[model samples]
Each structure stands twice: as structure tokens, then as C-alpha cells.
Target: MDTILIVNPKGGSGKTTLVTNLAGYLARQGEMVNLIDTDKQKSSIAWLKHRSPHLPTIFSTHTHNFANFSVKPSWSIIDTPAGLNEEILKKLLKKVDLVIVPIQPSFFDFQATQSFLEILNTKKPIRKGQTSVALVGMRVHPRTITAQQLEDFLKRQGFPIFTYIHDAQIYLQMASKGFTLFDLSPAKAKTHIEQWQPITEWIQNAHKI
Candidate 1:
């Protein structure tokens, strides 16, 4: 199974949003997926509970059984908590196949995200490129100055910005309705679904490298 950890030491960085949507995408494609919520808010857990029966299922796992050696799925998406420290990060990395860090266009998000990258940089595996990692820009407008700054920031870190999700109400609306962009007809969600193509494709190909 391929494991992905969605992390950002700062809250409201859309970690849960990435987790739920990515899990939904994999499941809709006929892959058995698991969603593990390590956040105290249990937002991912709640999202799965609210998920519609018609949509592809996202099996939820508890914290206690998170490191299970036997149970496996095609993909395992983990939603991490804010203010995660280096020690916990190292522990989590030991089990994950890839890491995704989300950033918003703000100082708070930038500061913490940069520091988080520093932590990852120190890891032997990260330095060796043994761990596949990517950066994501969340709720960003393509034409804004903030977007430019975020781009520069990510570029400086030497990490690829897989894809960006624009600031739109559809994400929130889908969350409330127990749905995701993948749950909607392509004719209606083509734009949003297109934004995720690169990220999903990257994950699918990571196993080969």
C-alpha cells in the first residue's frame, strides 16, 4: 500500500481538505483507500461519517491501530495536527511513502511551512530523496500578489508545487453535503477535478521511483 501524510504545523492550512479529497479521488477510481485522522478535531473522521453511501467508501482507522502491520489499502491518507514537532514528524515519516505540505497565502502559514521544510531537510531520507514529497498551494488566487509570493517561497524551498486549489465555496459546500469534486459529474466539476490531476498522477507514479 502507498501511504501519504498531509501535514502543516499550522492549522487551517487545508490539511483536512487535501486528505478528504485525495482519499475520495482514489476510492472513486476503484482503489481501496483508508483515511486516518490524527487531528484532535477529528475533521477527517467526521467527513467520512458524513460521506454519502453512493460515493466510494473511505475506510476510517483509529489512532491506536494506525501503525497496523497487516491491514493495507491501495492508498492511506493521513491528516496530521497543527504544531507538529520534529520528533513526531520523524516518527510519522518512518511509516509514510510520501509527504504533502499545504500552504495558504499568509505570513503565519508561510513562516510555519518554511520551518517545517527545514525539519524535513534535516532528515537523512529527505536529503537522499528516499522520501517523495510535494508542496500544495491551497485557496490561492492565481493572479494575486500573494500567489506570486507563495510561488517564490515554494521555489526557494526547492520543492515542486504539484497543483493549486483556488479559493472557492464549492469545497465547503461539498464538505457539508458529504461529497467531493470527484462525487460530482465531470461535466459540472471538470475545472476543480482538473486541478487535482497532477497531484493524483504524481502519487500514482511515485511507487515506480
Candidate 2:
């Protein structure tokens, strides 16, 4: 199975929101998707329980032996915690196919991501094949110069940034009701839907190591 880990060492980075919505979108596309919530906050777990029964989600606080579990889903999306714990983070990275770090367009969040990068850099060379990291710009204001500057800075720094999720009230409204962009009115949710395309494409094309 393909694994995608949504990781960020800072809170309010939209990690849970990205994971749940991405999983829901993939599931709607007929892929067997399983969501693992590693965050102690259990934000995704609460969302899963309240979500429609048709959506697939599994709550797990531990992933030491996750592969041993009887999960045969096509995709596994793991939502990690805000604090950077070496042991737990290392274990998860050792098992997943891709690591996605979601961050807001701000200096603090950008600095916070360096910690995750440092940890990944320490892993063995063999781990490189099974792991890839990308930055997702969340809650960005499209018209702001700071947003564009942040994206350009990350790209210039050799960071692989897939896409930017603009600051939209629709996302908050739908999320508050435990609904994904896939469940919202198409016309009203066009922005988020467009932003999510690249992420879905990446997951679909991920190679097995």
C-alpha cells in the first residue's frame, strides 16, 4: 500500500484538514483509502467519527507495527503530531512512501519545518528511496505579496512545494460541519478543489519502493 504522512512540527498548519480532505477525495475517486491519526489531539479521529459512514477512516495513536496490521487499503494517510519527537517521527518515516509538510505563509511555520527537515536528513541513505518531502502552503492569501514571496523563497531554497491552499471561508465552514470539499457545492468550492488536484495526482502516481 502507498503511504502519505502529513507532518508539521507546529500546530495550526492545517495538517489535519489536508489529510482528511485528501483522503476523502481519493476515496471518492474509488481508491481504497485509510486515514491514521497519530496526533494525540485526535482532531482527525473526531472528524472521522462525525463524518458520513461512507467515508473510511481508522483512528490509531501508535504506528510502530502498523504494517503488521491487517490493512490492505490502496492508500494510507498518516496525520502526525505538532511536536517533533525523533523516535516516533523516525518510525513513521521508515514506513511511509511520502512525507508532506503543510505550513502557513509565515516565518514561524517556515522555521518550524526546518526541524523536520533536519531529522529526515539524518536518516540512512536507503530511506531516501521510500521517502520524499513536499511543502503545502496553507491559508494563503492569493493577492498578498507575502504569500508569493514565501512560495518563491521555498522554491528557491530547493523545497518541493506542490500547491497552495488559499485562505477561504468555505474550507472552514465545510470542515466545521465535518464535510470535505468533495461534499460541498461544486460552484462554492472551486478554489479548494483546484488546489487539491496536484496532491491527488502525486499520490496516484507515487512509485513503490
Candidate 3:
């Protein structure tokens, strides 16, 4: 099984949104997917409970049993709380195959990711092939300068940013109505469908490495 950790050190960075949709998309693709909600807020778990039972999800609060859980599902996606300390984050990192840090295209979000990187870097040498980090730009406007600047800044900092999710009313609308991306309108569904390709490709490649 492959484990993907979705994390960010700041709230409103689209962590639950990313985790839920990504899990839904992957589960639809026929992979047995298990979602572990480590966030104290339990937002992802609540969302899953409210949504259709088509997707398989498991809500977990204990980080200790996380790594050893019999992840029968081929993919295990973990949604962790924002701003977790180095000690806890390091322990979680050791359990996952890849770490995905979702950040908004804003100075505050960028600054927040710095602390997360610091925690990850502290375990760098020992973490060589054990894990990889990917920066996801969420709720970004198409032509916004902030988006462009964030893209450039992340690149300059040598962070591996793989994809961008545009600011779409469909996401919020669906969430408010207790629906997943699959339940969105056709146009919105198409957008997510297109964006998911590269994300899944990168995930697959990370497992191979």
C-alpha cells in the first residue's frame, strides 16, 4: 500500500478539500483508498460521513496506530492538522510514502510552509527515499500576480510544486451541500478530472521511486 500525507501548517490552506477530492478521485479510479483524518477538527471525517457511501474512508485520531494499521486499501491518504510540531510531524512523515503540502497563493501561506519545510529538512538525510514533498497551489486565480510570484518563489526555493487548482465556486458550493467533486456540475467535474491526471501520475511515480 502507498500512503500519502496531506499537510500544511496553516488553516484555510485547502487541506481538507484537497484530501477529500483526491481520495474520491483515486477511489473512483478503482484503487482501494483509505482516508485517515488526523486533524483534530475532523472536518474530513464529517465530510465523508455526510457524503455518499461510494467512497471508502476511515477516520483516525491516533497517530501512533496510523503506520501499523492494516492498510488493506492500496492507497492510504492522511489528513493532518495544520501547524503540527516537528516531533509529531516527523513521526507522521516516517509513516507515509509521500507528503503533500497544500498552500494558497499568498504570502501568509508561503511563510507558513517554511516552518513545515524546516521540520522536514531536519530529518532530511535519514528521510532520503522514505518520503518526498509536493507543494500544491490551491484556490489560485488565473492571472493573479500573487499566484505567479508564489510559483516563482517556490521554484527558486527548490520546492517540488506539481499542480495548481484554480479558485472555483463549484468547490465551495459542493462542499456546502455535502458533495464531492464527482457530484459537481459537468463543467466543474471536467476541470477536476483534468487536474487529477498529473496529480495521480506524480503519486504513482513517487511510489515507484
Worst 10 residues of 1 by lDDT: 62-71
Runs of candidate 2 exceeding 4 Å displacement: 54-71, 125-127, 207-209
lDDT-superior candidate, 1 or 2: 1
Off by over 4 Å in 1: 64-71
Q: Tell me which residue pairs clash in candidate 2.
A: none
Candidate 3 weakest lDDT stretch, 10 residues: 55-64
Tens-digit per-residue lDDT, 1-209, candidate 1: 89899999988999999999998888988989988887778888887888878888889875733345333877888888888777777877878889999999888889988888988988876788878789999999989999998888888988888988899989989887668889898898999888889998999898556
Task: Write one digit per residue (lDDT tens) for candidate 2, span 1-209.
Answer: 88788988888899999988987787777777788877667788777767866554433343435344333577788887778587767666667778888888888877777666666667763245547777788998987997987787568545578999888887767665667887777897776799988887777778333
Looking at model 2, report the run of 10 residues with the lowest lDDT sum: 58-67
- Give candidate 1's TM-score: 0.94
Scored by lDDT, model 3 comes in at 0.74
- Which pairs clash (backbone N, Cα, C closer than 3 Å) in model 1? none
RMSD for each of the candidates: 1.6, 2.7, 2.6
Question: How many angstroms is residue 73 displaced in model 2 relative to the true structure, after the best TM-score fit?
Answer: 1.5
TM-score list, all predictions: 0.94, 0.87, 0.87
